[model samples]
Target chain A: MSELTLRPGRAFSMVERNLLIYRHTWPVLLAEIFEPMMYLLAFGVGIGVLVGNVPGLADTTVSFPRFVAPALLATAAMNGAMNETTFNMYAKLATEKTYQAILTTPMSSRAVALGEVTWALLRGTIVSTTFLVAVSLIGLTGTWTALLVVPAALLIGATFASLGLVVVTLLRSWQDTQLIQLVMLPMFLFSTTFFPLSVYPKPVQWLVEALPLYHSIELVRACFLGTGWRHALIAIAYLVVLGLAALLVAVRRLDRTLRT
Target chain B: MTTAPLIEARDLTKTYVTSEPYTAVKGIDFEVRPGEAFGVLGANGAGKSSTMRMIACVSPVTSGTLRILGMDAARDGERIRARLGVVPQDDTLDTELTVRENLLIYGRYFGIPWKALRERCDQLLAFSRLEDKGSQAVSTLSGGMRRRLTIARALINQPEILLLDEPTTGLDPQARHLLWERLFQLKEDGVTLLLTTHYMDEAEQLCDRLVVMDAGKIVAEGSPADLIERHSTREVLELRFAAHERQLMIDKCAGVTERVEVLPDRLVLYTGDGESTLAAVHALGVRPAGAFVRRSTLEDVFLTLTGRSLVE
Candidate 1:
């Protein structure tokens, strides 16, 4: 078989293994769900009262909660996917030796990479859906196209999960994971998640636009706020190409690391 | 009623190409017959694990050919792995999952139907003598229990061949013997067993035929009895002497014994009759501190070949 070709059934077995592990570790799932809600309540609702309306997609000015809520949806997906693929994946590769054990079976390294990213997508979907419902209940959702956020959340999840796996392969120790936090915390704050990109200078805006989180927030906000189909498509194509490239790199790295 | 070999390697070698390329397994040839209990006996860093990984089809052969179950290892890895069971050197049990779940989930990896796998899980738990500890977390088990669970998990799919890398390396004597009994049962049930160990007694007891490997090459290959008989004498006399009397004793023993190994604290004399040799030493007025005679074992065979002890 080609190196990249994966048997879906075998890949799903890894998902099944994760499910079995998570069955007893539901508290971790609870924490994943709880973090996004706290972020939504603290930033969207609590701070929205003081911030008033902010600039949204397509030059529209919207309520603070409505503006922040869609960005939180995207952040929720990013967090879910990033947490699973980074810390959890590092443990599997280094400490737990989980993937090494799996590769002993008929499951190819590519299938394992695919399965883990797929599992991360499931987690991202769960978190994004919950956050979407919370914002909708609070009257933040303004368009029927907001439901498109679910699929967009999946794309965001795939993009981060794939890229996060690549970053994790570079990790030599647990301390190196703090570097991930260094990158993520800044991106979470400056990716136009809590504020408008217009607040930044021209050079800063260009730098923000180059980040994945900025595109993720733009795609999610456009879908949730019914901004424009053209804008969403651009973001979608960027994320799709980036996700596939990162996934290819991640699979090849996993093969090299695990097989040898 | 000899059957074809179940696993074969021709000029098998594995060179890890890192910043500094190092060859672990030099060119070596061996074959494991069906239903045979085969072993690769060697010390640490002797390339035993590297060879096992190659035959298990996890590590690709660097410059040679390896075939398992009549399928090429490089091309038919997945298919070959589907029919093979591997118990790695360390316990890779999912510490997060319970013992029973470990078996069930691993069975699922082989695409075994859930119902059938569940039944086999119970049978394997029983076979490993872990019937009561099925629900406990793997982290809670003792080293021997964990090793047994790893073996049971490998058998979840009822594979045709079982590959164990130092299965009882760290276990206590009792646990090691218990594991040996289970492996004996498997051998009787017609499963091909391929194992690697540095323990000479383990190889002697469990391996029907084994190859003594050192520095990535096979130095000796035969049944334990045959190897001992061929490379060693019928008996061995061990004499421990004081530091000052060592050379004097060696010079004294040079006349009676044909072969003698001088260790740091003792001198090992190889002879057809150890008791007569000891008597001869006494007649020479060499009152050694300690003296004993015993039958030659695989340890002697290894020492005869490598000039070093197996464990050291």
Candidate 2:
């Protein structure tokens, strides 16, 4: 496939288009905040009562809410970005032909890919910030480094958004969409979100380490607990590399699909 | 108008690399001069949309050359597209947006300023006769209203060349005429128009010049009157008969007219003069059928060139 000669920042045109529609669809934005809050209430509060304090970084145990809060924040970032890229992007690309129409203009496929990822980042930031405020109010902040979660949420969002675009572009039938939920539910439940990696068998531990969500939770969890700087750097590098590769693949695939 | 062509193509081709590779356009050549309405007339799957998509700069040319507005289409697609307005065969309007907002948002894609686009948006709404429907959601609008809105959106950038593919394929006659009037006005204002349609009347009414395409190739090219005069006679005499009598009548009527097209239920006789031809048919002593004479049209030209009717 030929590479597109991308124009810098032209992707913002797509961002503006989404913002225009966002005027009437603010209710969807409201739902993003509450979805994670519901998880926090049930998993962090309800389950935390029985599970008690789990093992934490540096051999120190933290409160149950504090332990689960960062993981939930990372999940929120992933969900926020993935939701925008998967179903909504699919409708625009396959059903509504929005990208097909846009291609007639000066906009290239690269711009569309970058623009959607940027919008997903914005969405991820909004919901994660709200969650951060709620957890901080409940006295979950163990250190000032928890402020780093906002930028970390953006990284997590970007990574998932790019990866989701790659998947959505490859999606051929509506029935295949169930595959996304199948993968997401397992990753969310088993990515050390509610439990530690030590609880899993050695083979399962290696599998969880390979999953993207595990790295995301570890990165965000380190931010709140103020430890694990060396591991955090590795996690950040992993996400950054994965996000760039997915973005490249998404743009090339979109260019082939739209221009063909 | 400048003498130089606004768009030009030489041996342009488009082939799909599917499981079974299919070639949609077969090395055709054409040009659109400034301020003229040029058309490609063909039936479904004759490669008209593929040609339009290539000219619109959204589809890559498989081989050969296409240049729009003096820039190479392959190398300068973005620059050429920036100066062109395209109305695709399907209505790709954002159903989630209001009519005016759709125009505003589309204008932003061209990097138009918000204030200028708002003013232009109002003008476009009035121009397409959708002024009252500006704030309505796109999903609430009727088919004709949506088509007009799509046209309005295409005009947001004040494009020098307008490309429309099947601009009124499925519209009611009244809506089609209304759209024709709007397109005529745009031509009067000097925007070069390139459109494709299977409707011969639409080609005759809007196109200054056109090419007839069949099975990925151009069969004939000329003004509508020129094509009719070149390919068909001055008039056509139609005679309908009982199913069994049609085959017998074809042999009987062969020598009376210049050409005879045997349809399923009717025999279309092409002649220089319909009256003399009908008189000649009567002289043949076969009087057991219905008959009529009419002037030749682009439809007749299409039939003569392609050996098939435009609709089929």
Candidate 3:
């Protein structure tokens, strides 16, 4: 039972390495922005024209784009974090053997895990912010509180990134990563991202609320709607606890895998 | 007063307990003094890498005491690792990065300051002979160039001890010689080196003293010259017979030398005097198809000690 040790400087070095890589490949950043933009355009704006109003808001009725905008922010964060931690992390660990090189230096495995999750959070925040701006340009923002969605998106990203790192430790091959798509797609479609959980049956609604992304969507939606601070705080606590627990598991797994 | 050894291991062991338990290192003992090149010479799966990993502080010793740079490896891994440089068997260069960026990022991992790390990166690029290719993506570099970059990256920390595991297992002859020359310069600069290799010539060329390992245990340990003198004869007489006459030639050549080894294509006769041994074989009315004589090498020492050839 070796205790995990962290040096913030070492962890920041990992982030800096990724930042250099991102700098060279800035075009890929546009691709991250594109995915959520497509979702917002096709579902939020296009479908909002047909669907008149949504009833889940606390005070007054809102159009479909305003209701769906915050959920897209949560989804953007989840996607960005998952892509970095799962595919990029696995590439470094198994395919490229980059972690082997990093381990030889003074950096600990725990530091590597923390640094990777932080990078994922950064990417998630960037994508979510881009989505927030796109929605504002489309005049979907209702309140000044919508700006708070950025932090909520970061919390969502941290939770998913930590969970993704845990999955990477258990992965045996590139093909196993397809299973992540299976888990994420269902959560993306059914976790109250595109619609309110009230649309589902009672038991199905309970399943939707039980998901990690559900809390993220609930928090971001509250921020955009300017209502439900108490419920939003509960969602924030849920994501914090989930992210911390996943982070602990990820650190332990990285230690076991790399330090062996 | 006597100074402490840079690396000290007493009965260090490593056992892997996956589905079925298997021991990789069977409690080997060795010490590397400061400013000396110490080598662990063995064939693949002989636990050389396992031992090197433990010393690198990346892998923990399963049992027994191990100290590196005067710190316990199990308890002070990070502290030990901070002062050490490691080149693993496989090249772990970041293919996505340029050759120079690889050195820079690796230096940053050791928390080297940015200004100093940039200077070190330039110096290391020159050291590895990749100064012109600093901006080239690592994937575009040849295997030898990639290996050199890895070694250069390891040195970015100005470590006291450098650990190399099979550093030249896959290089061409020219590449191997170039690497050996660079390593010699490192040795001259007073960096203590601990390396593992299955190449007998590499061990003979680089090591001041080495241990020959087989099946997870050291069979012999000494300087290359001393091991050859103690374990092997002065020279060897190689006699190749035609097909189907190999075993017959072994029987005929049995009493003419100290020992005879029957390889696939030839029979190696170990003796104090190779010419005399050849003369004795001819005097016995057995004319070999071809014959040659050479001085004993670390290969011969390994063969004499293990009763098996070093390369398999």
Candidate 4:
């Protein structure tokens, strides 16, 4: 037989890898559009109908959707990242044994990990940007500051993509997916995704500040209304560290699992 | 073919620790020279798969030495693997991809350029008889088709030494023969192959040299011709009798040949002269319903050395 460490570029192209699932699941891709639309309708129209921009910040009044728009943009990015890193990843590694097939050639475990992570980031970024455009058409934000949400979304995606792989490696089977649902659902709910942390207990607020998703929410939220520099910087830092640390763990675990 | 040994394993052993600590492979020495099609014949749970996994670099050896292409399996596993092609027992193809895509992706994993990969994919597709199934998802393919595709995929990089782990275990006869023909071509092209199979006929047909593994140890090792010539007669005369009458023939044929082994419905005589053996049996007034003299085979050698009684 020919030599083994298959060159990874010959496997699935990054675009091909992530889009393979997306191309077949247009409905899921389109579902990303509805998230921002929901924020526009519920918070922008319904909640804005009552709150009427009374709380802090600028002197002028703004819509409620505008308030949640940034958060939703961040949410969409996180959601897109979550799906790719979790379900798609599980299917590839466990059910499909796609990585095994790749490794049979010259591709190492590192390439497989990096390929999937990079693919997730790309998919997450694409969805985040697509959501941004869709929301923009619906008039979510006016200033160019909202455009910054694109990269912010990608960072959020990258962080979770790697983190999700770490989770996947530990995950026993499809039956154990309840852990994914149970863990992520609460984090999404309590991480200030829907409501601001100021509404929580001061002690709880500090805890929220430590959460990666909370920082991402804050970064995207601030970016939506413009002037989100400091928190965005902090969120970027968290994502960078989270992404690298999770990637390192994932690579080590993959090396161990595939090597033996 | 190079004079250097393509694969060399010195005192290779693999042990597993569990509720039952078992020694899977107990310090066995193995070597396959270039252009040699070597086979490991074993029953189930014989540690054949474990040995192949180690050679493929997917499993780490517990102890002893293994060198592929003269590079240490422990240190240069990844490097050695790059020059080897492995067709695992399980069909681990990407079901999501077409036949062409599978070859392309696998070639790319080897870092082949896309342009070159495309050409190689076409050649492999045709080589595997998958030319018409280029766009077909692997899930939609038949077992034989999938097996062929896997072989083709393994060849995408033109490996020097091929490792086949029960390569045709579940294949139909026609598919198996077709695969064997392809493998024969590879061998003629000077590709060194390490194969594992339980089929004695397969070992006889494909291997230039073979080792019979029973419970992790090599019980017998030699070329098929050498093995049969050494352990058995030039020809095998078969005699069959009624279920209840087999013992009578066994009684009659005791000294008819070099040796006679009794079975439930048949008796096999290891002899130099089939016609004389048959005449001797007939002279005893015992008539067998069927009779034939065939060439000796590796199966007869296995039966001779390992005993035909149930191993399990």
Candidate 5:
């Protein structure tokens, strides 16, 4: 393999290429915006009417719509990040051979990995921000601390995006992409994105707590509710470590796969 | 007498360490000088692409030294790559983008300024005869047009050394000729070219100097004319007999030529005077189904060196 060098500038060029493609396919971006909105409408408003307010351990009661809003924000981040790193990355690597073309230039595999993750983070940010605006208009979030969801969603996006890249490198065919939907559906349902962890059995709750999406939901919820700063910091630390570790693995995998 | 070669490889080897370890390129030595059209000629799986990959700085050499433009391939890959234009065996153009957009994005990868890239993109489109299809999607183009666009994309950086791996592998005769003309223009512009191909005609038409590689090693090296002059006879007499009668004919034509290569359906007789050889064979009470005499080509040189045809 050639020397692996990380040039942030070259990574940004990859990001620019994605942006250029997205410019012509703006409808796809619009479609992604609707996924989080529909989730919010179905669970937050439709189901909230029947569930009413949920009790908190600190003698507080949070409305159902507000409770599910932050979890959906984290879900949006995961969906956005995973979609790009899996389908788009796979197409570029296998079908299109775009990564091979890029490698011939000055950009190294490290740059391609970094650039892809960064693009996923940007897409995740877009989805999370739009969801935040829709949720705020529906009177789901009242505190200024909700703004922190942007960075929280970004962290979640980076973590899942890096993991998605690793999965793509291991994948052999389009059929392997089905494995992503399998894992993602479980994470979406069982990670407390639609309901609280208390609804599940203690063993199930423990398993959910170990999930990265569960940590993301915890952090985003704490920010929106303007409470649980201590737990929020823990969630931030967990996501930060996960994102960095996954990024390192992703870069190493891309280097090995693309170079030789 | 001591000027460094533009591209140099000494004892370069590539051993793929997969489940079953395989070595694609054995230790070999070659040099490509500035502004020369150099070629690596070989059949499929002859380590041509592996060698090209190492020189392109995308694949690291398993051992030995490789320098491009006086820079070490392993240490200064980025610097070397910035000045190298590479046309890979397969077309890697972004099918989603327009022909012009493909060139634009490729130029951007080299950090070319937007204004200059736009101008250069136009020049390349014209050079590739793709100006009329500038706004068309790459997927809509024909195989030959796509190939031209790929070559245009590589030249977006105006690279000093252009490495083309089988530039005309799968194209019609007309398209191949047009591509050859364009590549000739690039050579005339004083850009050093290093291309690999199994097509003897392509090598003869485009290359100034070439090496014939068989398996993993360079078997012969010289200009096309020189290689033919040194390794092959002046002309070849091809005689086609029925499948069952080829051996009998070969035995009957003993001592008629310098060498005889028997194929599945024909026999190749290497001799200085093919017409006289054909007449001599006919005088032996053997009449071939078909007979033709032609001057020797690089293919005959490869056959003489490797004991196999170039296409096979």
Candidate 6:
């Protein structure tokens, strides 16, 4: 056929394909949801009763559920994004040689990377939406503004997921899966996900504020409390820049890795 | 453009360097015309896969020219890949998706829209005899079914060029036959094919023209029949002796053939006339367990050029 061309959306098609895998592999997806719910119960409700509400929070204008709920939304998005992109991406790229199969056709490594990030976003959106709905039903949501968290969660997921792609490509074996646990867990814990940056020492506050998850928490908190245009704008800008930068690095790295 | 060659490589070489440089594809040249089944026969580490990778455009050449369907591989690699189908030595099908989804998803990689992919997947599933396995995950399919799905996936773009790297390397005989049947059908539809293989019978059965490679260089090039006729005798005799009585039979028929090659297990006598060679051996009181005259084949030509079988 004349004028035939293959588009990079090939990776997007796999988003649908991946959803099918998720459809059958629900236990895996459910497990990711349970982690955040457990934190919400154990820390937000159980521990909040004993410790009282976390004060001087990033969005201190809200109650305890509203405060911790946004943090949980950001954390769950990060968790889902990292879980989907890191080990799954590694397993498929390494042992399964999934992208190799796609590259054999008209697909480029950029398409594969793009598709993977898209799927991660889709997955994170699902987890974020489900968690947002659960928190709203439990009367934690202050406004319909909680709905805006979907796109914000997508942005958060996109940044972490594609960054996960960069890491996955550079890692040579399963031994390197350790890096995600060591690196990401600490980032999640210390990046002001549980409390606002002001709770940390001034220097540590600056460090936490610089983290991608911190920006995600900022965005989610602003969206959850139904307030602050400037705050939400800054958070979105941070993640958008981080996402695009990580995507560019990943596309370039993947192009070298698979095409060369 | 009058039916440009599906694949062309000139002085193509690929070298992987880390601590020390190791060359894989060593300055080889060849062309495969549209719809032609071209075979690359080579011993292990002889650069066949590296050459295939360059033409597939998934790999870049360190030096030399390579083109697929008139497009430069170094530039417009994605454009070139759009018209190219690659069946790598290993089956690279995604295990997570179904057989049908595999085709649909890959077709999209070539930028085929969803509506068209849905239609194309059906036709390819029929062609590869994978229609029944469409929804089943590829991980559950048999080896043959998985291979058929791979072939189907490659055709999703209806590529003008198809590259098969050792297409039948690890298949059972029945599976090999099924794969060959599917390939033959594609050839009938005018898809140009380039294949790398070490199997003599596979090359003989599928290749219209062939190149024998040794140490990453072309040693001989021609049709299977032409190569066999040019490099080997019309017939050969196999001789074996029990225990260690070879000294009595060593000189008996030494002068009867153009050449004699001895192996630890047996002896081969290459001759133009097997009957006369047999008579000469009888006259010298030498007898063999089996005396048969068979048509020459590509294996003999390959052995003559590479000094042994491609696998060894």
Q: What proportion of true contacts does candidate 2 retain?
A: 0.65
Q: What shift in Å separates residue B269 of candidate 1 from its native position after superposition? A: 0.4
What clash count does candidate 2 reach?
Answer: 0
Expressed as tens digits, the lDDT of each residue in A1-260 for candidate 6 is 55365544466766776876776787887777778888998878876776566677544455565667788889889878877778988888888888777777666777778877888887787788888888888888878887898988888898888788788779888998997799878887887666666778888888887888888888988888887669789989888888888889988988887765
Number of the top-ranking candidate, with DockQ as the measure: 6
State the lDDT of candidate 3 residue by residue for A145-180, as single tens digits.
999999889889899999998999999999999999
The CA lDDT at A137 in model 1 is 84
Name the weakest run of 10 consecutive residues (lDDT summed) in model 2 chain B: B241-250
- C-alpha RMSD of each candidate structure in angstroms: 2.3, 2.6, 2.5, 3.4, 2.3, 2.8
- Give the runs in model 6 whose Cα sits over 4 Å from its true position: A6-11, A56-63, A143-145, A198-207, A226-237, B1-4, B246-256, B282-292
lDDT of 3 by residue, B11-68 (tens): 9999987898889999899889999999999888999999999999888789989999
Task: Name the runs in model 3 displaced over 4 angstroms.
Answer: A1-7, A56-60
Instruction: State the lDDT of candidate 1 residue by residue for A83-146, as single tens digits.
Output: 8899999988899888778878888888888889999998788778887887788788878999
What level of docking quality does candidate 2 show?
Answer: medium
Question: Which pairs of residues collide in model 1?
Answer: none
**Weakest lDDT window of 10 consecutive positions for candidate 6 chain B:** B303-312
lDDT of 1 by residue, B95-148 (tens): 778999999888777787788888888899999989999889898899989899
The candidates' DockQ values read 0.53, 0.52, 0.54, 0.41, 0.50, 0.59
TM-score between candidate 6 chain A and the true chain A: 0.93
Which TM-score value belongs to model 1? 0.97
- For model 4 the local lDDT of residue A67 reads 71
- Across A76-108, the per-residue lDDT of candidate 2 in tens digits comes to 899889989998999898889999989998898
Interface RMSD for candidate 1 relative to the native interface: 4.9
Model 4 C-alpha lDDT per residue in residues B1-312, reported as the tens digit of each score: 458888888889988766888889998887889889999988778789989988887777899999988888888766776788889898899776677777876766676667878888888888888889998778899888998888888888888889999988888999999999999988998888899988888888899999888778888888888888988898778998876776776787788787777755568898888888888889989889899988887778877877762233
Which order, best to worst by TM-score? 2, 3, 1, 5, 6, 4
Instruction: Give lDDT for model 4.
Output: 0.79
